[model samples]
Target: MKFFIKLCIVGLYSIPFAYLSVQTDYEADSKTNYIIMSLIIGVLSYFCGLIRADLPLIFGNIISFSVSYFCNSIAMLDKKRADFFTPINSVEQIVLITVMSIVIQVIFYKLARRFAKGYINIIESNNIEKEKRV
Candidate 1:
C-alpha cells in the first residue's frame, strides 16, 4: 500500500534525525534553547512530511526530537528530577533516551495527526477562498 511505502521512507529519513537527537553535543543548556531547537526540528520534519504526504512521519519526528530535548532540559534545569535522568555520557542513558523518544512518538501520533488535519484544513480553506475570488 502507499501508506506502507511512505512509512518506510519516513523511517529511512529518520535515521539521521534520531542519531542527531542523541548527541550530547547538540544538547541545549537552557530552556529557551531547548524550545528553539525543538521548533527547528519540527519545522524541518514537517516539510519532510509535507513532501511525503505523511502526517505520522511529521509527528514522529517532532515528538521524538521534542521529547529528547525536553528530557535533557529537565535534567539541566531541575535538581530533583535531574537525578532521575541518565547522564548523557553513559551508554545506558543514551539507550534510555532513544527508547523514551520512540515511545513518546508512538503514543502521541494520533493527537499530532489530528492537529495536522486541522492545520491542513485551514490551509485548504484559504486556498479555496483565493480561488473563488480569482
Candidate 2:
C-alpha cells in the first residue's frame, strides 16, 4: 500500500513534468529560462518525494533534468515539428516562456499534491472499514 502511494505521488509529479518539458519552446535567449525553470521543478519534486523517503521519489527527482531535456528535444522534433536547437533570439520570448513555465508549474504541483492526498485518504478509509468489519 505504501509503495503504491509513493508511486502515485511520484507519477503525479512526473506526468506533467514530461508533458510541459516537451511543450516548452526553448530558443537561445530562453535557454537560460528553461534551465532555471527546470531547476525549480527539480527542487519542488525533490522535496515532495522526500516526504515519504521512497527510492523512486529520490531517483526520479534527481533525474528530472535529463528527463526534461530529453522530452524537450523529442517534442521539438515530433510535436512542434521544429529543429532541435533553435536559440531564443529575443529577450521578450525568454520572459514570456519563463513566466508561463512558472504559472504552469505552480498549478500542476498544487493539483498533484491534492490528488495524492485524496487518494491516500480513500485508501485509508477503506482499510479502516475492512478492519471494523473483521
Candidate 3:
C-alpha cells in the first residue's frame, strides 16, 4: 500500500516533465510518452530501494539518458527538426529529466520508510497474539 502510494506520487510528478519533453519536440504524442516514462521511473525507483548506494543514480541516469536520446533521435528523424541542439532546449531537457528522477527517489524513500514501520507493527502484533494464544 505504501509503495503503491509512492508510485502514484512519483508517477504523477513525472507527468509534467514527460509532457514537456514531447511538447517541445511536437512530433509524436506526448501523453503516451509521459505515461510510459512515468511507469518506468516509478517501477525503477521502487526496486531501487532493495539495492545499496550509487545504484539508484546509475540506473536513473541510464534510463533518463536512454529515453531522452531515443526521443530526440526519433524527433529528428521524423520531423527533420534541429531544436534539440539549442542551449536552452538542452538545459530544459536535462532539468526536466533530472527533476523527474529526483522526485522518484524522494517518493520511494518516504514510501519505503512507511512500509517498514507498517511491517514492524504487523510483526509486533503477531507476536503479541501468539503469546496470548500460548
Candidate 4:
C-alpha cells in the first residue's frame, strides 16, 4: 500500500521529464518509452527496500541503465537517444545523457528517502514485536 503511493508519486514526478525527452516527431511513443523507464525504476527501487534504503537509487539505476540505454539506442522510438536539454553533437549528447542520469538519481533518491523512511520503520517495528512474542 505504501509502495503503491510512492510509485504513483514517482510516476507523476517523472511525467514532465518524459515529455521533455521527446525530441522526435513520434511524441506519443517517446512519452511511453520514458514512462516505462520510470516504472522500471520505481518497481525495482521499491523491491530494493529488502536490502537497504539508498540501494534503490544506487542499484536500481545501475541495473535499469542498460535497459533504458537499449531502448534509447534503437531508432524506433526517439531519435534523440535519451539526450535531454537539446544537446547537438556527440559530446553534447554524452553530456546531456550524463545530466539526465544525475537528475534521475537525485529524483529517485529524494522520493524514496521521503516516502520509504516511514514504511521500512513500520515493517521493522512489526517484525520486532512478532519476535518478542515468539
Which candidate wins on lDDT? Answer: 3
Residue lDDT tens for model 1, 86-116: 4544235545545654455444444556667
lDDT of 2 by residue, 1-134 (tens): 87776676566445434335334533332345456556665555444533533465545443543455555545545533454435652233334544565555556556667777887999999999999999
lDDT values of the candidates? 0.51, 0.52, 0.56, 0.48
lDDT of 3 by residue, 1-134 (tens): 65554444444443444435555545563446656666666655555453322343454455556565555555555433555346555445656766776787668756765676687899999999999999
Error of 4 at 66 (Å): 10
In terms of lDDT, model 1 sits at 0.51
The runs of at least 3 residues in candidate 3 whose Cα sits more than 4 Å from the true structure, single-residue gaps closed, are 1-26, 50-59, 66-80, 84-87
Off by over 4 Å in 4: 1-32, 53-87, 124-134
Q: Can you rank all candidates by lDDT, best first?
A: 3, 2, 1, 4
**Model 1, C-alpha of 98: deviation from truth (Å):** 1.6
Rank by TM-score, descending? 3, 4, 2, 1
Poorest 10 consecutive residues by lDDT, candidate 2? 89-98
Compute the lDDT for candidate 3. Answer: 0.56
- Clash number for candidate 2: 5
RMSD of 4: 8.4
